[model samples]
Target: MPAIVGIAQVVSVGSSGVFHIGDVFTINPISTAKTFAGAGSFITGRGISVYNESSLTYTVDDEVMDQGINFNL
Candidate 1:
């Protein structure tokens, strides 16, 4: 069974862009750029937009892993 072990909130610096459920984003270094999850980049968690806010902020679920990687989801 899958459960939410952790939660994260990301804020957009330049443009909030479009985000959807299951959209993954990087957490480390804390970036607001909209970079796709499996796009040869480090991923921290999966996006979980619950409400429609205008502050350019998003909620994500932390990914479970034994070790962190530099790229890839």
Candidate 2:
């Protein structure tokens, strides 16, 4: 058994990615991501003084994912 391809177009590919035309025995892909954010208000110093009052703001995130993929033929 065989395959015949006339035309093929590819846009983009990310990390740990693969592209094949003929055949493959085994394929494995892995990816990871991380993000951080901060929000606050401060008005104080050792040698400096602040006369104005400020509000406080806080933010938190608690979601994480660890995954993997494997393909074999």
Q: Pick the candidate with the highest TM-score.
A: 2
List ranges where model 1 is wrong by over 4 Å: 1-5, 13-16, 23-73
**Model 2, stretches more than 4 Å misplaced?**
30-73
Weakest lDDT window of 10 consecutive positions for candidate 1: 30-39
Give the TM-score comparing model 2 with the true structure, all chains together. Answer: 0.35
lDDT score, candidate 1, position 48: 38
lDDT of 1 at 21: 39
Report every candidate's CA lDDT. Answer: 0.43, 0.54
Task: Report the lDDT tens digits of candidate 1 across residue range 1-73.
Answer: 3355456566764343453335455434322333334332353567833443443433463756434344532
Candidate 1 clashing pairs, residues 3+ apart or interchain? none
- Candidate with maximal lDDT: 2
